[model samples]
Target: MEEQVNVPQIFATDPKLFRFLTKVIHDQGLTPGVEWKVCEGSSRGDNFIAVIKQVVHVAEGGTALNLLVKSAPRNAARRDAFGIREQFLNEIDVYEKAIPRLKSLVGFDLPVADLYGATSSHGEETILLADLKELGFCMADRRQGLSKEQCAAVLRALAQLHAASFALREGSPEEFAALAESVREMFWTQPRRHAFEPFMRNANKETLRLIREYYGSADCDNEYSRAFRQISDLGYDFLANIVTKVPENKKVLLHGDCWTNNLLFKTNDDGFVSAKLLDFQLARISAPMIDLIFFLFTSTKPKNVGNYLEEFLRVYYEEFERRLKTAGFTAAKLYPESELLADWIACVPYGLVVAGILAPALYCPDECLPNLESVKENSREAFVNEYGKVMRANTPESKEHLGQLVKLCVEREWLRILN
Candidate 1:
């Protein structure tokens, strides 16, 4: 005899949502007595994510299913104020449309979450997905950073992702164009960009202060300092004008926010076996180096990046070329290693700026996170105030991370490009 499990109270609270879940379960040919319990997710994500453990009773036995439910904040004002509705739509588009196209074009499943269903209306949206944890996939610790093998696995996965886009562009140009047109650059949108400008300016100020404090006044005007100062002075304008600009020639669908938290790794006794990308809300058509640099600077440890930078680039490029060739395209004619390296060099400042803004939030304790409720009530002022609190809370770690990043940039003569 099978032990009976009671329905969780969490699922009982929303009859409408429960009905949707019931339908989804039924559509999969599972028996109906579905019960769910809430699980934990990221604190910093714009939307609310609830990992629900669902138990379904069939004729022979009862099986447990873990489903990830992501929903827009209930407050409509907050959704509009933060432009979260648009972000949610972008993610929905990627999962519902882009992923299917990629699978058909590339003849394989891309490394992303399997979506069960999604709903969007006006300011509200909800998505249900298979919880990756059920498949032994877990997030790498953002604070600790990734090991070399883990980093390699991520690069390889990213290579495959990028190659799929290239193949799509070659095989079905119109379809690829339509897919690109469907998604917008989250950071470049007017409302979100306005909200982000103040944070960028503040981050620049804090970064400059850290540089001077660490390097001393005597060294403050050195090559690195000069380059940092130039960008800091330019601040948000630099971001708007240069960093976010898309090169016409080498655009690909980017994972936009390619940090550690956005990635999940499954490891076995030997090592990291596979990885999956999450958070497509920021996905956009852009230079592939944007994703590459974002991942390199914000996710991996400074030591690993310093030690294996060239090797990592090689792994990504080689895998990218191999995939492109497998997809019946000449890798050399389409995207050579030389061009890739050049694009990376050109995008170093973009990586630095992103790391500066992301480090504080990534390092801050959960208790130190901004009160989004306040932002919902008073968007701009509340957000800026909370941003300051977060930045102050994580200053020490942010400084250390920024210092290493700046040092790496200077050593590689990446600062010379500023001249």
Candidate 2:
């Protein structure tokens, strides 16, 4: 592993993990004598699964280099609580196996941060990735929400990733099967799902409480309470099944979690140039609409949705079709418009269920978030009791957006919440 004494104190904290990071620079054609330093990669609450560290290095004569290192939590209690290891391994598998095959199909068109290296075994996991910020890409404000223009960019970027999945699968079924089999579903497994069940149910309860405090207060009629009561009855497994058990030939390796924060945008003098997808921790092979619904409702500004939801869908469709045909693949026939709509309708239920957790955290203030970098500081089990209480209070943005999403889903008939 490059002599341990030469390693920076920040990285030297974890020798095995450092071994993986050092190999990354070497593979990139760097000399052993290169200078390197480490610093906090992201702000608090911005990342949870791993402690993100940015390693900046300067070669003897060439340009300086900055890269991100995602190191797994070493504490077993913190790591296993929410299946953090499985999620990290799933992401590692995607970078090592799936992304390369798909990138070969789409060339350099796929808009994910460059993958340098990934390693995980016997509970120590780490992945080295390109820092998108170094490439001038920045995330949108999760609280203020994304504008129509920004949303269009993300949809187009998502379209490219989704399209590549189609080209690979249709062009070579065996390769696609191998790729799919390698990626583990982050949620909905036996022990993990069971562990997550109570947390999810409580998040739902918190949603109802927030709704009562926000929307319910403004309404003359008790719509929020009545709606979620029906939601509470539908049960958890039903929603999980709709997301996990897609009828064959209808799923893709989704970014799995596509909120505003994970979708980064790059702009030039003229305008927005590109968007890069980030954080593959929850990456899973699931229905395409799950990603769509997750991004639109949970991550978007409440004002941009409701009656205007179809505009974003149109944006996704046009770009996706253009990409598929350009790749020498068939047009809309690959995913018939009718079937796409059906799949979308089926996915809304899963979206509603996930919003309970994603929505609250979407706009939570920094102080409200649990300190994830320190193991004992905020263990998942300890935080589970009060998932959305970020610093003991819910932000208005989270509550308002979540409530609006429910109303919009009902209005569009995308979901059925009996009242």
Candidate 3:
């Protein structure tokens, strides 16, 4: 057996549990001697993640094998400040249920390492998973905006995902609803609703500053500022109403947080090839159209957005309807294609509230360029230049998308002055 090096402090403090965890690994069919190593995950405030790596040797004595060992924070006492219960644990439960259902349906191209369940002598839960890089996957580049072709790829993928979830719900209503109810602690809690209020207040101020900076000094009553204000005021209302507004008796698993960062891309030796969905931390059962609308507004580039918008809607409707039929619902009774966009448009304010945050806040000072420096320059003009990227309407693609969106808003009498 290879001697283990000094593992990180995360494992160092719990030597006895480490030994027990390794023993469970041996029970999985490896020999008695497997070395454990430490792995790291990005920090989320006070709570942190660590992985245990165990090198396994077959008892029959041929080749050595590598295995990933993981545990949620074993410290039950450590759960107070970070809101870990509502976020992290909720994700694990949802993924455990959803992954099996998803695999049984479409069988995704994205890689999933192994999932092994473990428990401490005290009954705490630990999970061992296969690492993605070992299966040849890496995170996607955020700097490269989603290309038109890439947009098509993700749209098709979303269709399958939406279809599968809808089918599952329709085919096994009680079981699906039970699973959704199981994870409702994260989505339907009062905390999340409260969390949004403060976040929205801050977001509203940031968006207004962004809009004024992008568009020139028009009176506060001018069309541009008026439009900005209209949406900003209604932001929370739109978010709160999505569940009520969606088609009655229809709910699908929604990737509640469907931004570019959460949707990872996979590439081959050639270039960008496919995308993988990630961060199920906020996944929930909501309107299917919510995911589609979120992806279009928040992730796609302003310019290419217009051309692809209709195409995407058409694709999603066809797929959703097809899957509904496969799962045994009539087209007329289930999800109607014509109603999809109307449903989508009704959800536009929610989209704008989400899109308004991406450009300025999403990218770090490093990945997003030109404007990154502008924000630091701290001049009124620089701020305007940075904000105008979203507000002033730069490319023909953007103008097309925004124009349609504005027209929709006008029809709804939303942000009414923008009309």
Total backbone collisions for each predicted model? 0, 2, 5
Candidate order by decreasing lDDT: 2, 1, 3
Q: Give the TM-scores of the predictions, in the order they appear.
A: 0.89, 0.91, 0.71
Candidates sorted by TM-score, best first: 2, 1, 3
The candidate that achieves the highest lDDT relative to the unseen native structure: 2
TM-score of 1: 0.89
Tens-digit lDDT string for candidate 2 (1-419): 73533778876567787777667777878754468877888777677678788888776576576888887877776676657788888888888888888887865468888888877875778888888888888877777777788878888888888888988888898888888898787667665677767767877777777777676463432565556546766777777787788866767788988887687888889985577888888888877888887887777666686646678778888888888887877657687655666777777767777776787677787667766543344555663433435524567877777677777766677665343
List candidate 1 stretches off by more than 4 Å.
1-7, 43-60, 189-192, 216-223, 234-238, 241-244, 371-380
lDDT of each: 0.74, 0.74, 0.55
lDDT of 1 by residue, 305-412 (tens): 888989999999998998888878877877788887778888787788888778876677767776665554445445546546667765566667877788888887
What C-alpha RMSD separates each model from the true structure?
3.8, 2.7, 8.0
Better of 2 and 3 by lDDT: 2
| TM-score preference between candidates 1 and 3, better one | 1
Give a tens-digit lDDT track for model 3, residues 1-419: 87453344555777765565556556667554434344443221111222234433333354344454544444343323224444555556656776677557543422234455434233234555555545565554443457775666566666666667666676677767777786653433455666456656666565555555445442334454467577777656556666544554567777676666665456678775565565555677778777777777766665565566778777666755665566556655666677776777666766776665554433333332233222455444454455334333333333333334444455455443234
**Candidate 3 residue 5 C-alpha distance from true site, Å:** 11
Look at candidate 1 and give me any clashing residue pairs: none
Superposition-based RMSD of candidate 3 using all C-alpha atoms, in angstroms? 8.0
Top candidate by TM-score:
2
* Pairs of residues clashing in candidate 3: 114-130, 213-384, 214-388, 303-397, 303-398
